[model samples]
Target: MSGTVGPSAAQKRNYYLIVLSMISMFVTTSTIYMVFPLFFEEYGMSGTSIGFLISVGTFAGIVSSIIAGKYSDSHGRKPILFAGVAIYAVVFFLFAFMEKSFTMFAILRFIEGFAFYMTPVAITTMVADIFPPKQRGKAMSLYTMS
Candidate 1:
């Protein structure tokens, strides 16, 4: 029940967590961005179509961020985080096997965008939970910087 507990200890713990979260975020974001380029040549996707696909995903992320943020603020964070990750993993696996179709890709990207925001909202909430008010800004800055 008890361990080395102090402000510095908590800060060190959170610093590591934030670093890991940032790495996760980078990988996810890179995957989302790279998917378009990786498949475009093989799938014969035009630049315009790829642009549209990315735009739709970005738009969906914006909407999902707002909705998920509000929803998580009211409800607990774990459920939303779990649901989001589940949706993301399922959709990503499906996308890997699905036939190349713009319509299907668009739908998948939309869903992915929605689920992706969950990680950010959840991690941010977790960071807030761990850090006090005065330290939260610095913690978040470190999270983003990493």
Candidate 2:
């Protein structure tokens, strides 16, 4: 109860966590999204098929966001964050082994989308909990920027 109080320590920690979360988000999203265009020709995925691949991931992310947000609101942020990151790691590992099959790649991307959604929601909730109302806007903006 005697430790550092109010915005100082919390703000510093929240800033750091926000930065970490942003980096994680960017890396995860870019890794999944960027590869499609880079190797679509080699993979033989037509523009429509590539769009489907991206759409599946995005749809999964939307679903995951809804579920993760509710769970985090009820349970807490750390567990959701850990689970998301863990699943993300697993998905990336799986993606590394993707063969010529478009179906398998689509499935991997969808799962990755789900996992990626959890991290951002959890991190944003964590930031909201840590920062004051007046500062949350700035914190969220910074989180998005970085």
Candidate 3:
């Protein structure tokens, strides 16, 4: 009686969840992306410095994703996702009060990247958990498009 039980249609796919996840990601990313140059200029950073700031965040994300992926496995997906989102919101809100210190902004950007990485890690893991092996690829594609 313990052979296996593949996802039986309903549990294997959830269009609403995928779409909502995508929309949420879009809003978060766009909010920062659309004002990249102006934000840096107002903060008095040169182009090279701005680029460096972005690079720091990218590098941090690489490290963060590896650690978060492992942590998510043991801690469960929902908590990671929630924490990530919460941290992300707090970081963005802090921007309003951030001083004109490039160093501070760079550090926060790195933190933002780390927190944001958790979202996708948790989401993809949650998707795989819900979908059957056979449908996983397709589900992933749909999620990615979102």
Provide TM-scores for the models: 0.78, 0.85, 0.84
What local lDDT score does residue 96 receive in model 2, on the 0 to 100 scale?
Answer: 76
| Model 3 CA deviation exceeding 4 Å by range | 1-15
Highest-lDDT candidate: 2
TM-score of candidate 3 versus the correct structure, residues matched by position: 0.84
Q: lDDT tens digits, residues 27-143, model 2?
A: 766776677576688887788998898799899999999999999989998888889888988988887777878888888888888988888888888777777777778878888
Model 3 lDDT tens row, 1-146: 11235555555445456557657866878877888788877877887897898898888888878977998899898788888888888988887689878878888899888888877888888877876677678878877877
Error of 3 at 88 (Å): 0.7
Order the candidates by lDDT, highest first. 2, 3, 1
Which 10-residue window of candidate 3 scores lowest in summed lDDT? Answer: 1-10
Q: Pick the candidate with the highest TM-score.
A: 2
- Provide the clash count, candidate 3: 0
> Which is the better candidate, 1 or 2, if ranked by lDDT?
2
TM-score attained by model 1: 0.78
lDDT of each candidate versus the true structure:
0.76, 0.81, 0.78
